[model samples]
Target: MKKPHLIVPEGMEFIRDDIGYAPAVLAGNTLYISGQIGRDDQRQLVVDKEAQFVMVFENMKRVLEAAGGSFENLVEMTSFHTDMRDLPLFMQVRDRYLQGVYVAWTAIGAASLCGAPGYFLEVKGIAQLN
Candidate 1:
């Protein structure tokens, strides 16, 4: 049986230790990532919708790289949003990062997130490592 390895990427802030959950985990060839909010390196929540969207993806990118993968390695993704109407804006920011890289995706509308009040969205995913 393959053991699951907890992945803690350098330079990324994880509240998991203080709270309870890993940012991501590697089990076999798959990397499972937890939901990433638009928190900055200093742990401040980003208020701008577009900026927050970008930050979410950037955080995901960092996690993917730490797990020895890239945006192209992402097989699936799920996004939770406080407002579904921001999908267009979210797509705009997402396209800038992905630049045509395609992956299975899901978007969900939620009333609120765990601890982020001004946060507009959260992104999580699964990546296949090479």
Candidate 2:
């Protein structure tokens, strides 16, 4: 069997150096992605909730694409949110990204995140090779 490739995107060093985790992991046919924050491709956090949701999903997509996978292949997801009020807005945002794809999802409340003013939410997921 061919070993699954380990992929780190060209500009991902910012994630490792400052974000504090590997962006994605490919072990055999499964991909385990680290939690993605509301940061741009440049790694700057966007404070707007709806906009941040889009930004965070974009980050997640980049990692998934690097692993040769996509959202439709995802089986599970967990979201951590500092404010519960944002949950409904998050659902609206999530629907935009997850159209036609159903993922087993968990949403949790958190007191804080690693960054100041904190993120509206953080998202993580697992994907199977298709």
Candidate 3:
């Protein structure tokens, strides 16, 4: 087994320095991305539900790129939502980002995420690097 390499994208140092967590970890060719919330580049929670979904996917994309990968490299993804009713809207936003590249995905419902009230959705993924 190869040692895992931590991935921290620029401007995301707070994830490790302040949150004490690696945003993503690359073990050999597999990149395990941590759950990404609906926060903008400024780390502020996005208020619009649909836009918030976009931010979550965008954050995940940043992590994937940091690991030398892209959406095409994603093998599996898991999403947690505070409200199941948001699934329709979430899927709409997700499909826009994913385009026609379909990967194994699982959507779960949770009471809360990020240990905060503003966050309604969180997504994490696993990607295979070239």
Candidate 4:
């Protein structure tokens, strides 16, 4: 049998989206994390899109940690948003966390996310393990 290339720790999701895909996938020294939405572990859509944006980003951080990686290891990021007008706010909040270790980023205007009204953003990331 082929063993998993990376070991995701307990409490981290073992995502196998039957109808779609997972939050992340690790192969070799590279991790391809799927876009993260603004939902808690219970799948509740956060009340505010921007707040949820931050939350989802934080969630992504946790997922990275569980997989033995750090935010600094991220090489790229992509954000999908329902409203492009909220870019400044998103940038403000996103800037609060990441410093000079800025990764390549792309933001797109989206129609709707996977859930409720306030849940308007999703973030996906790619990281290379050290």
lDDT of 3 by residue, 15-130 (tens): 65666688898999999999998887688999988888998898898998888888999989999999999999999998888888899999999998988897989999889999
Compare the candidates by lDDT and give the number of the best one.
3
Instruction: Decide which is better by TM-score, 3 or 4.
Output: 3
Against the true structure, candidate 3 has what lDDT? 0.89
Q: What's every prediction's RMSD, in angstroms? A: 1.4, 2.2, 1.4, 2.6
Q: Model 3: which residue pairs collide?
A: none
- Clashing residue pairs in all predictions, respectively, total 0, 0, 0, 1
Per-candidate Cα lDDT values, in order, are: 0.87, 0.83, 0.89, 0.77
Error of 1 at 85 (Å): 0.6
Clashes of 2: 0
With a 3 Å backbone cut-off (N, CA, C), the pairs that clash in candidate 2 are none
Model 4: what TM-score?
0.85
**Which ranges in model 2 have alpha carbons more than 4 Å from their true place?**
1-5, 15-20
Candidate 4, residue 45: lDDT? 72
Candidate 1 vs candidate 4: the lDDT winner is 1
Query: What lDDT score goes with residue 42 in model 2?
Result: 71
- Candidate 4 lDDT over 1-130, as tens digits, reads 4444543434445556575556677877788887787777776777876778788877788778877888888999999989999889888878876766699999999888775566678888889987
